[model samples]
Structure formats: C-alpha cells, structure tokens
Target: MKNKGVVFTTQAAMIAAIYVVLTVVFAPFSFGSVQVRIAEALTILPAFTPAAIPGLFVGCLIGNILGGAMLPDIIFGTLATLIGAVFTYILRNQNKFLAPLPPIVANTVIIPYVLRFAYGEAIPIPLLMLSIGIGEVISCGVLGMILYFTLNKYKHRLFAL
Candidate 1:
C-alpha cells in the first residue's frame, strides 16, 4: 500500500516535470494567442492514470508562471487544464481515441477568453477562439492521440502503479 502511494506520487511528479520542460523548452509555441502548447499532449495521460489530474494542473500553473503569463492566464489556464484532465480520467474507460477530447474542448473554450481579457490581445475574440482552437486540436487532438496510441501499447509496463 505504501509503495502504491509512492508510485502514484512519483508518477504525478514526473509528469509535472515533463510538462514544465516541454512548455519551457517550446516557449515560442507554448504561449500567446496563436500558440500550440506541445505540453498539452500530456493531457491524455489522465486516461491512463488518475494522478495526471493534479499533475497537469500543477504543471500548467508552473508552466504558465514560468512562461510569463498574466494573472488571469495563470489562474484560468490552469483551471482549464485541470477540468480537462478530470474529464479525461472520468472517460478513461471509453474509446482510447476520445482521451484527448476533453483537453481540446476545455482549452478551446477557455483560452480565447484568457487571451482577449487576460492578455488584452487586440485580436477579436472569435478569431482568438479560432486560433486557440486550432492550436488545441493540433496539440491535444493530433499529438495527444499519437501519444495515446504509443502509450496504450505499454500501459501495463509504464503505468503499472
């Protein structure tokens, strides 16, 4: 039992660290209204492990702060990731292909507002939505799906906790 908890904590911490690295390393494409945060691909991990819920949230929070996001972006953007991770965990039993949908939708719906109101972007809200949505689709849908498929093949070995 103690080992299980340790494994879960370790997994979550590792995931969070990986997310921060990906976000910081890809800073150019990880921020701004027209951005594709490659770290979002990790959002799909919730479908395999519940620890990812908080992992992604904390990761996004730190990533946002380190990325020089405004206050609202840090708050709301982290919430968006948390919500998506929870939903993904809830839907874990469904089709593997659906694992990325929650993050895609959550970020698509929440980030544009963060951009317009938080960052005071001059771009119209609808256009921001379009751009953010496109970025989410690429990060969560395309890249996440690729990750999902690859990890699915080694779930037992990689996520055995």
Candidate 2:
C-alpha cells in the first residue's frame, strides 16, 4: 500500500515535470492568441490514471507562470487544464477515441476568452474561438490521440495505478 502511494506520487511528479518541459521547450507555440501548446498533448494522461489530473493542473500552472502568461491566463488557464483533466479521467472508460474530447472542449471553450481578456488580444470572439479550437484540435485532438494510441499499448506497465 505504501509503495503504491509512492508510485502514484512519483508518476504525478514525473507527469508534471514532463508537461512543464514540453511547454517550455515549445515556448514559442505554447502561448499567445494563436498557439498550439504541444504540452497539451499530455492532457490525455488522465485517461491512464487520476494522478494525471493534478499533474496536468500543476504543470499548466507552472507552464503559464514560466511562459509569462497574464494573470487571468495563469489562473483560468490552469483551471481549463484541471477541468479537462477531470473530465478526461471521468470518461477514461469510454471509447478510447473520446478520451481527448474533454480537454479539447474545455480548452476550446475557455482559451478564447483567456486570449481576448487576459492578453487583451483584439481578435473577434468567434474568430478567437475558432483559432483556439483549431489549436486544441491539433494538440489535444490530433496529437493527443496519437499519444493515446502509443501509450495504450504500454499503459498497463507504464501507468499501472
């Protein structure tokens, strides 16, 4: 039991670290009105284990801070990731194809407002939503799905929570 706890903590920490690294490494596209945030690809982690929920939340918070995002972004953006992760975990047992839907929808719905209000971008709301949705589609929908398939094969061993 104690060992299981340790493993859980370790996995969460590792996921957080990876999220931060991926966000920072891809800093150029990780933030801004028009962004893809490849680190979002990790948002699918929750489908594997609940630990990924906090892992992704903390990672997004830190990534926002390190990426120098505005206040609303730091708070609300992290919230978006948290919301997405929670939903992803809840829907984890559903079709594997649907695993990324939560994060994609959460970010698509939330990020446009963040970009407009937080960063004071002058884009139209609908346009902002479209751009943000496109990014989410690429990051969480496309890339995240690819990641899901890759991890699915090794999930039993790699994420044995």
Candidate 3:
C-alpha cells in the first residue's frame, strides 16, 4: 500500500510538471485569443486515473502564473481550464472513445468569451468559436486521441491498479 501510494503521488506530480512545462514551452500559442493549448490533451488521462484533474488544474495555475498574463489570465484563464478539466473528469467513464472530447468541448465553449473580453477581437462570435473550438479539436481532440491510444497500450505497466 505504501509503495502504491508513493507511485500514485509521484505519477501525479510528474503529470502536473509535464503539463506546466508544456504550457510554458508553448506559451505564445497557449495564451490570448488564438490559443492552441496543446497541454489540454493530457486531460484525458484523468479518465484512466482521477489524479489528472488536480494535476491539470495545478498545472494550468502554474502555467498561467509563469506565462505572464495579468489578473484575468490568472483568474479566468485558470478557471476555464479548471472547469474544462472537471467536465472531462465527470464524463471520463462514459466511453473511452468519447472521453477526450468533453474537455475539448468545454474549453471550446468557454474560451471564446475569454478571447472576446480579454483580447477584444472584432471577430464575430462564430469565428471566435470556430477558432478556439478548432484549436481544441486539433489539440485536445486529435492529440488527445493519440495520447489515449498510447496510454491505453501501456495501462498495465504505467497506470495504478
């Protein structure tokens, strides 16, 4: 039991660190209106292990702080990620194929408001939605699917029992 707990803790921390690092590395595309937010793809891991929820939320908080957005970015930005992660965690068990889409959808649905307000783009709502949603589809939907397959293949070895 001790070993299992240690493994879980280590795994969660590693995931959070990876998420923060990825967001930092992709800081340019990750912030402001036209965000790709590739790190969000990792949210699907929560389906396999619940640790991913906090792991991702904490990761986003760290990313927001370091990425250098002022108040709104730290507050609403992290809030958006937190909400998206929660939505994903809730629907994680419904279907393996469908699990990744929730976070993508959640972020897509929520991020446009942030973009419109934070960046003040003259872009229309549909355009903003399309841009953010498409980005998420590529990042969370497409990349997340790939991660799902990779992790699923290694579930026995990498994940907790």
lDDT of each structure? 0.92, 0.90, 0.79
What are the per-residue Cα lDDT tens digits for candidate 2 across 16-93? 999999999999998887889999999898999888998999899998999998899999999999999999999999
| Model 1 lDDT on a 0 to 1 scale | 0.92
lDDT per residue as tens, model 1, 63-143: 999999999999999999999999999999998888888988899889989888887899988888889989999999999
Clashing pairs in 3: none
Report the poorest 10 consecutive residues by lDDT, candidate 2.
1-10
Candidate 3 C-alpha lDDT tens digits along 101-140: 7777677776777767776768887888888888888888
Pairs with backbone N, CA or C atoms under 3 Å apart (clashes), candidate 1 = none
- Whole-model alpha-carbon lDDT for candidate 2: 0.90
RMSD (Cα, Å) of candidate 3?
1.8
Model 3 alpha-carbon drift over 4 Å, by segment: 3-5
